[model samples]
Target: MRLSNTLLALGLTAVEATQFWHNTGTKSGWDAYTHEHKGTVDEVTDQVYKGSTALRMTQIHDSSYSGRYHSEAVKFNAYKKGDTGFYGFAFRLQDNWQFSPAQGYNLAQFITDFSDLNCGEDYMPSTMVWIDGDQLATRVKYGEVCPTDQQKIKSFDGLKKVTAGVWHRVEIQASWKSDNTGFFKLWYDGEKVVEAYNLPTNVGDGRPFQFRVGLYANAWHDHGYEGTQGTRQVWYDQIAAGDAFADAAPDKW
Candidate 1:
C-alpha cells in the first residue's frame, strides 16, 4: 500500500512539472479568469483565459476557446454590422491587422498600424490611444459610423513611438456623461493618449454598451491587405471593470 501511495505522489509531481514547463514563458501571473474558466482549454494554443467565478463569459456563445492563442493580431468583429458593445485591452496589433467595414454600428479596430488609412474607427463616445511605429497618437471621434470625415476632438503627436514585438500597455475608459452623452479616454504605456471628454451625438451616451475582446481576420478591398488576412497572436491579462481604469503592474500582483 505504501509503495502504491509513493507512485501516485510521483505521478502527480511529474504532471505538475510538465504543466510548469509549458507555461513558463507565456504566463506571468494568474489572472482572475484562470480560476473561473477552470476546465476549458484551448485546443489550438492549449492556453486558457479563465474568468472570475462570478464573471464568466460562459453565457456568450463562441466567447471562449480551447486551443492556442492567436498567432497574429487580426481584426475582431464582436458586434455585427449593427451591434454595439464596449471592450478594452493592452495589446500589440501588427501592421497586418484589418478592420471591417462600418455597416450599421460596426467599428473596425487596428493597433500598432501607424498609417493614417489603416487606423480604424471606434464607436462614437470612444477613445483609442495608439503608438504608431514612429510616434504616439490618440484618436478621439464623436460620431457613429466612420468618423474619418468628422473633426477629431483630440489628437496628440508628441508621444514616443511604440516598438514592435515589445509589450506595451494600452487601455480605454468609457462612461456615461448624460442620458445621451458618452465620455471616453485612452492611454498608452501608462501615459494618457487622450483626455476625458464627451463623445459624439450619434453614439448617444455609452452607458448601455458592454465590452468584448477578440480577433477578426477578413479580406480587404485591395489584395494589398495581406497582413489583415492572417491570424495574429495576442496576450491578454488582468482584465477588470470599474470606474477607475488603471494598468496592471507587477507590484499589484
Candidate 2:
C-alpha cells in the first residue's frame, strides 16, 4: 500500500496543522473552490480513490483558437511567501492514454493572474506538475513575478512513468520564498523524488498564489496535437492543503 493509504489504514494522526481541509470533489465541494473553469468539470462515480465520487476534467481538441485546454480547479490565496505547507491530491489518468513522445499533459499547478498590471506578464504559473509522454515531470519558477524574461524555471523530469487506470498520490511540501531561503520537496506515492534546498521558489513579490489540479493539454497549444487520442480525461480526489502531511494526505483525512 502507498504511504498515504498506509497511514489511513493504520489510523495515524501524528501530524498537526493550522487547517485541516479536504475536498471530496462532491457537487458542493467543487462549486465552492473553483472559478472560471473551462471545458468539462464534473463529479463522476466511474472512478474514485477514497470517496464515492471524484472530479473528472475533460478537454477536447479545439481548432478554432490556439489557447490552452485547461479544465482545472483553483483555490485563490492558497499560499504566500514564508509559509511552509503541504498540498496533496490523488489522481488517475485515463486508461488507454496516448503516451506519445514529446506530448505534455499538465496535472496540477500553482499560479495567479497578473494581467491587470500589464507589465508583460499575464497569467504566470510558479510551480507545475505534468506528464511528458509516460514520465512524470514538474517545474518551479522563481525570480520576478512579471514578464517571462525575468523568470527562471528549474525543472525535474523523468521521475517515474505513471500507470494508467490506477490511482496515484502526490504530496508536496514547499516553503514559499523569493530568495535563497526556500525549499521544495515532492513525494510520489510515498517516495521522495525531488528535494531542493535554499532556492528561490516563488516570485519576488509577496503576492498570494492559487493552487489548481486538473488536465491541461499544453502540447496541443505548444507543439500541436501529435497523437490519435485528441480527447483527454483525468480524475482527482482527496484534494487538500495544510501545514501537516496528514492534513494533505488523502488517506490521512
Candidate 3:
C-alpha cells in the first residue's frame, strides 16, 4: 500500500497518554516488575504497564550496575501474513551497566564486541518483533529472514545505528503492498533511517508469533560470571503499540 493511503487508513494520530500504562518511578503506580541490589546497588523503581514509578538500576560490583527492570503489562498480538503496523521506544542505558548476556532486555541497551571481557558472548533474544538473524541489531551476518519461506531480503546492516547511554526514538513501520510488494522502514528521532522494499516475507500473515516488549540478558550463561550482585536498570516511558495512521493524527480509536 502507498504510504499516503496507509496513513489515511490507519488515521495516524497520538492517542491519549492515559490510554497507555505509564511505568515510571513514583508511588502508587503499576509495577510490571522490580528488582533491588544488595551489595552496593540500591532499589530500582518500576512503573511498568503505565505506572508513575521510574525504572531504576543501581551500581555496585565489577564494572556494572546490579539491577534490571521490565514490564509485563504491555504485550503485542502476533501479525498475520499481510498485517502492517508501527512500533517504537525511547530510553537511556547507564554507563556502569556491564555488557553481559544476562542484561535481559533493557529498554535501552549497549552493543559491544561479544568477545570483549566485559561484553558477554551470547545472543540475547527479545520478545520484540525483528527480522530473524544471528546479529540482533544489525544485519552484519545475513539479512532480513522471512518467517514464511525462510527467504532472506535486503542486508540488515543498512538498518540505523542505536546510540547507547542516550535517549533516542526508534520507530518501525511495516506494511503489505502485495504478497511480494510489502516493505518496512525505521526512523530515528523523527529522521528516516532505514527503508526496505519488497520484504522477503509478510508479517502477521499466518504467523503464530505475536510481538512482545521485554528484555533478555544472557550474562548468566557466561562462564565464571555470577548474576549481578546488584540490579541494573533501564527506563522506558511513553510506549505505544498499534497501526500508524495519518501524520500527526492522535492515536485514539
Candidate 4:
C-alpha cells in the first residue's frame, strides 16, 4: 500500500492540476497585481474570503481627469490564444453602496495594449465583468482591435444582483480563440449564469491579454456620476486562475 500511494503521488505531479495561480491578497507587495490608478490600493485584514487579508480598492470622484477614477488590480499576460482558463474571485461591495439607476461599475476584465496597431484604439479589453446598478453583467468582445468601432461586443446583462456588505464569488471559464470555435461560460456564487458555444472570444491577432479585477467607477467618467455615493470601495480575495474548475474555485484552493 505504501508503494501504491507513492506512485499515485508521482502521477498527480505529472499532470497540472486545477490551480495555476492563486492570490489571497495577504501579501505586502503588488508584484503580482498591476494597475494604473492614482487611487487607493491596499491590503486590509478586516474582511476576507479564506485568508487573513483581502485587497481593497477605493475610488473617489475626481475632477482632475474628467471624472476618471480607476482603482483595479491586474495580472498581466494572463491568457493567450488556444488557451482555456478558468478565473475565480471573491468580492464584496461596500455596505453603504448606493444603487441608483443603470450605471456601469466594471469589476474584472481581460485587456491588453493595442497601441502598436495605430488603429485609434490604445488599450483593448476582450472580456469584462461589470455592474449595472445593483445587477451584475459581463461581455465577450470579438473581431479585431481597430477604429474603435469595428469590434463586436456580446453583452450578458442581469446575471445576479449585487448585495452590499456580503461576499460573492464569480468564476468564468473561457476558450480563447480568434476563430469561431471558442466558447464562454460564467458562474456566480456556484450557479452557472452564462453559457455560449461556438463563438469567437478574442481578437484575431496573436497577443496575450492581461486579467484585471477591481473597482472602476466608469459611470462617473461616462455619465458624470449621478449616484449619491462619491467614495466607493470593494474588497477582493481568493483570486485564482487555472485549467480546471477546481483549480480556480474558492473552496478548492
The deviation in Å at residue 201 for candidate 3 is 3.8
Report clashes for each candidate as comma-separated counts. 25, 0, 50, 2
Residues 108-152, model 1: lDDT tens digits: 132221133343644232333433333555544333233456433
lDDT of 3: 0.36
lDDT (CA) per prediction: 0.31, 0.79, 0.36, 0.78
lDDT of 1: 0.31
Candidate 4 lDDT, 159-218, residue by residue in tens: 988899999999999998878999999999999999999999888877888778888887
Q: Candidate 2: which stretches are off by over 4 Å?
A: 1-17, 30-38
The reply for model 3, stretches above 4 Å from the true place, is 1-74, 98-155, 158-164, 176-179, 202-205, 218-231, 245-253
Q: Rank by TM-score, highest first.
A: 4, 2, 3, 1
Task: Estimate, for each residue in 1-253, the C-alpha lDDT of model 3 and write its tens digit.
Answer: 1123232233222343222222222322322222323322122443332344333433233445434232322232223345566555544445454444333333322121222223343222212322111112422111223331332334444244444455555555666333556676666567765677764433222422223233323242232244553444444444444555222111122
By the TM-score metric, which is better: model 3 or model 4?
4
**What lDDT is reached at residue 237 by model 2?**
92
